[model samples]
Structures are given as structure tokens and as C-alpha cells.
Target: MLQKAFKRYIDSFRGFSKEIWILALITFINRTGTMVLPFLSKYMKEDLHFDYDHIGTVMVFFGLGSMFGSWIGGKLSDKMGFYKIMIFSLLTSGMLLIFVQFVTSFIGMCFAMFGIMLIADMFRPAMYVSLGAYAKPENRTRAFSLVRLAVNLGFAAGPALGGLIIMGIGYKGLFWVDGASCIISILIFATLVKEKKLSTHENHEDTEKAVVKSVFQDGPFWIFLFGSYLTALIFLQLFSTLPLYHSEWYHITEFQTGLLMSLNGLLIFFLEMPMVTFLERKQVNRLKLILWGTFLLSLSFFVLLFDNWAGILIVSIIFMTFGEMFNFPFTNSFAMSRAPKGHEGRYMALFTMSFSLAHITSAKLGLGIVSRHGYTTNWLVMGILGLLSCASILYLKRIVAQSK
Candidate 1:
């Protein structure tokens, strides 16, 4: 029985195409070097001695670059193709990582980080477009999950190793490793992944003849985007504020913090795909799953108020990871579902832009809250926002159903 169960688990991967698997592999490789961003806040505070306000401001710049990158990357992917955009992004961004090591001044670092993120984030929308190109409609959600699984697997390795690397070689090791990882992924993609072809039908016989609908005109998508944005605002705290919180409140070392961060990725890596597979088999409502996920994600922050930092953190991260599992891939799948064949890049760009916007708001707003009102108030506000996000998802469901 155990043997059969394990075989079934292994067989689950057979659903997606080989191209999708390659995409997953590329993501895994790139994310394995994802040591830099997760620890950027800590580096800023400790190594550079930046205040909360300056750190938040730097993050806002990161978000601005991300927002611009996604918008332009999506547009470029639609026009130029995913392979070109992704290859360019990976190569250029990798070079920028090494440059980031030298910037010591606050203004210089902020500008450097922005440039790095701008080039780096272009990969996201292009990756989303590639997933749509590769996966069949029925396999779309799982395809996204598979890519996310690769991401989590890489993340599982990155921070845990990064903590040790920081101790041994210092932060410069993070930059070099991250840069090398990006170059490695680029080589893999350039050699292994074939560009998806554009048929005459999708292009309307030529690029100029293709009719692209404005994302703003799609009412249900607008609602969906807003709901995604709200959830992102709450979820993004994990990157921006949570690390600092862990260091300060728990008095933990960088390795301990890496372990805490890795816990989220580890849980999602082992369980999310299987859990999502079960949910799909049960015919769970996608919108309902997103709603519950957002709620749980929000509640995870509030769990900090309960007093036992160690145990509560473990429990909270579990809930947060589950919430991430439900909302993230499905949300991307939904955006893909809504796009007309030729408009995949634009639709995905707009959808990704929501999270970019959230990165901006969450950092500036969350850090500001902590600086002024305290972490307790920040958690309370996030919990309330999460409930509001749930309501938005329900309303979004109604809008989608009405449109159908």
C-alpha cells in the first residue's frame, strides 16, 4: 500500500508537458540563487546601518522597478516572444548582481537595487506566458504549481545554504552565488528550451492584425486583479518585514531566521502540489480556495500576538504556506484562463503588476506602521485587510460568474 501510494505521488508529475518541466527546471535553477533578495533587508540594516525609513524607501524603489519590468516585459513577450525576453532578463540581471556588491551609499544602493529588480522581474511575466504556451488547458493549474514547486525546492536550498555562506564568506558570497545561478539558468534555457511558435491564427496572419482587448475594459479581471493585489499586500510582508521581526523579536541568528524562512518553502515543496491535486480531484471552487487562502495568510500574522515566538512561528508559517499554495498558482491560472490567445503576455503582465504594486505598498506601509504604531498594530491591520480581501474575492467570483 505504501509503495502504491508513493508510485501515485511520482506519477502526478506526468500531467504537464516536457516544456513545462523545463520551465520548472529553469525556475529551480534561478531561485536556487535567490539568496540575495530574501536577506536584502537584513543586509541593509546590519551591514549598511540603514534606518527603517530608508530601507522602506529602497524597497519602494525595488517595487517601482518591478512594476515597470512586468509591464514592459509582458508587452515585449507579446511582441518579441517569451524566449528572447527571458534570456535577456536572465543574462543582464545576473551581471547586475555583482555590481550590487560595490554600492555602499544609500542613494546608490537604492538605484542599483532598482536596476537589478527591473531586469530580474522581467522573467516573471515571460515565465507565466511560457507556462500558458506549454500547458494544455486542463493541466494549467498543475503546471503553474509544478513551476512553483520547483521554486520552493530551490528556495528550500537557497536561504538555508545562504545563512551558512554568510557566516563563512560574508554577504559578498551571496552576490556572487546569486549571479552565477542566474547565468547557469540562462545557459540551460538557451540550450534546452525551444521557443513556442506563433500560428497564423493567433497572430491574425500578421502581428498588426491581432486585436488585443484592453485589460481595463475587462470588469471581472479588474475585480480579480484587485483581490490579488489585496492578498499580495498582506502576503508580501514575509519578504519586507518578517525577517526583521524575527531577528528583533526572537533574537535569532541569521541561520535560525533562514530556517524559519525555509520552513515555508519546505512545507509548500512537500505538500502543496499534493494538497492542490486533492482539491482539484474534489472539484473545489477555485475562487473559494483563493478566498480561504487569503484569509489564512492574513491570520498567520496575527498568530504572532499569542506570546510563544518559537512554536507560534512554526504553526503560523504552516498556515501561511498553505494559504500561499492555494492562492498563488490558481490566481495565475485564472489570469491565463481570462486571456484571449494572442494576449497572454498582456493579461499576465497586468496580473503580475498587481503584486508589483503590492510590493511597493506593503513595504512602505508595513515598515511605516512598525516604525510608528508597532508590530501588533501592523498585524491587526493586516488581519482586517485579509477579511476585506476575502470579501473582494467573493465579489470577484460573482462578477466572473455573471460574465460567463
Candidate 2:
């Protein structure tokens, strides 16, 4: 029985192209080094002596940079191609990250954060478009799952290691490691992945059927993007406010908090690929799955209302992780499918922009509520937002059905 299970796990990884594997490798390398984000809020609050409002403002800058970076990345990918964009984004962002540790003042940190993220996040849309270029239509969703596996695997490692790094050398060490990782990951990509024009043949039929000339004209997609924004807004709390909660409320140490956060990535690493493969084989309705995932996300926050037991944190993360596994890969696949061949970068940019916008709102709104009301109030608001996200997606499902 164990042998059969292992074989199934192995089989789930089969049939991907060489480029897909290389992409996954670079993602893993990059993400494993990305120890800064999970710890950024804590660092600002504890090290720099910033208040919640200041931290929120800095994060707003971060998100703004991400939003603009995603937009330009998509446009430039369409013009200059994903390869050059990927190199420039990684290389420039790495240097900026290393420099960020020096900026101790609130205003300096804000501008530095913005600059780092603006260059950094350009990789997102370009990477999504690259998947469309590289992966086969039949296995595209699974391919997305594979890259997510790399990301989660990196997440699993990054925080745990980051915790130790903080314990040993302080937060300054995180900047060096994060910066080096970006450079290394890009160098690896530059070495292995050769530049190529997007193949028009694979998506020609879908492109032909596309009636909307501009991404703005795609009404249902806008609805979907809004739903995505809500989901992202709710999920991003894990990085921003939740870490503070772990320290303040639960009295968890940074190392312990890192371990708890690592659980999220570990769960996705072990379960997501096989589960996604099974779902693909079953050919389930993507929107239905997304709705269920959003509902789960709502429950994850609501579970925190039972704050009597520290164990509830574990249960809450489990719920969030499963919800993430269900929502994100399918979201990528659906968004990619909506793009006409030539305009892939634009469609993907808008899709990625939803998350960037959410990142902006998530920090400010969550921190504001925590400052004014409390953590419990914040969780309740997020739970309500998750429900609204579900409704938006359901409405999108109906719109799509009517369009068909």
C-alpha cells in the first residue's frame, strides 16, 4: 500500500517538459532565499521601533511597487519577452534588497521597500507567461501545481532557516541571504534557460475564439480578479498581522513562530501536487473548487475566534493551507486560459495585480483594525471578506456560463 502511494506521488510529477522543471528549480531557489517577507513586519516593529501605522505605510509602498512592477513586467514581457525581464528583475531586486538593510529611518525604509519590490515583483507576471509558453495544454494545471510545490517547499525551508539566522546573526543576516539567493537563482536561470519566442501554435484556437480585444473589455475576468483580490487580502494576513499575534498573544518565540509558519509550506509541499493531479484527472469545475476554497479560507479565520487554545493556531493554518492548495493553482490556470495568445502578458499582469493590490490593502486594513479594535476584530473582518470573495466567484461562474 505504501509502495502504491509512493508510485502515485511520483507519477503525479511525470510528463512535464524540461523547461518546466528548470522553471520550478529556479522558483525553489528563489523562494527558499526569500526569508525577508515573513519576518519584515516583525523586524520593522521590533528593530526599527516603528508603530503599526508606520509599518502599514511602509507595506503600502511595498505593495505599490509590486503593483507597478507587475504591470510593467507584463507589458515588457509582451514587448521584450519574459527572459530579459526575468534577468533584470532578479538582478536589480537583489542589489536593492542588500541595500535595504541600511535604511533605518521610516521614510528611507518606505522608499527602499518600494524600490526593492518594484523590481522584484516583475518576475511574477513574466513567470506566469513563461508557463503558458513552456507547458503543454494537457498538463498545464499540473505544471502550475509543480511550480507551487517548489514555492511551498522553499517556504517550508526559508522560515525555519530564517528563524535560526535571526537567533544567530540578527535580522541583518536575512538581507544578505535573501539578496544572494535572488542573484544565484537568476544566474542559474541564465545558465540553463535559453530565450525563445512564445509559440503561437499551442493556443491558436483559443485565441481565435477570443472576442475581447482589450483586457478591460473582459467583464467576467474583472469579476474574477476582484474575487482573487479578496482572497489575497485575507491570505496575506498570515505574513503581516499573524506573526505579530503569534509573538504577542501566544508568547511564541521567533523560532517557534517560524516553525508554525513552515507548517503551511510543508503541508502544501506534501499534499498539493498529488491532490491537484487527481483533481485534473477528475476534470472538476474550476470555479466550484475555487468557491469551496474561499469558503475554507473564511473558516480558517473564523476558527481563530476560538482563541482559548494555542492549538487552534495549528488547526487554522491547516485550513488556510488546504484552501491555498485548492485556490491558487486553479486560479493561475483559469487566468492563463482567459488570455488570448498575443496578450498573455496583459491578462496575467491584471491577474497578478489583484494580489499586489490585496497586499497593499491587507497590511493597512489589518494593522489599522488591530490598532483600533484588536486581533479578534481583525479576524472577523477577514472572515467576512472571504465570504464576499466567494460570492464574487459564484457570480463569475454564472457570468461565464451565460457567455458560453
Can you give the TM-score per candidate against the true fold?
Answer: 0.88, 0.90
Candidate 2 lDDT over residue span 231-317, tens digit each:
999999998799999889999898887778788877887788899999988878888888988999999999999998999999999
Against the unseen true structure, what C-alpha lDDT does each candidate score?
Answer: 0.82, 0.89
Point out the worst 10-residue segment of candidate 2 by lDDT: 201-210
Per-prediction RMSD in angstroms?
Answer: 4.2, 2.7
| Candidate 1 residue-wise lDDT, 68-176, digit = tens | 8998889899889988999999999998897788898899988998888888888899989887777775567888899888887887778878889899999989999
Candidate 1 segments whose C-alpha is farther than 4 A from its true place: 42-54, 198-212, 240-260, 302-305, 308-310
- The most accurate candidate by lDDT is 2
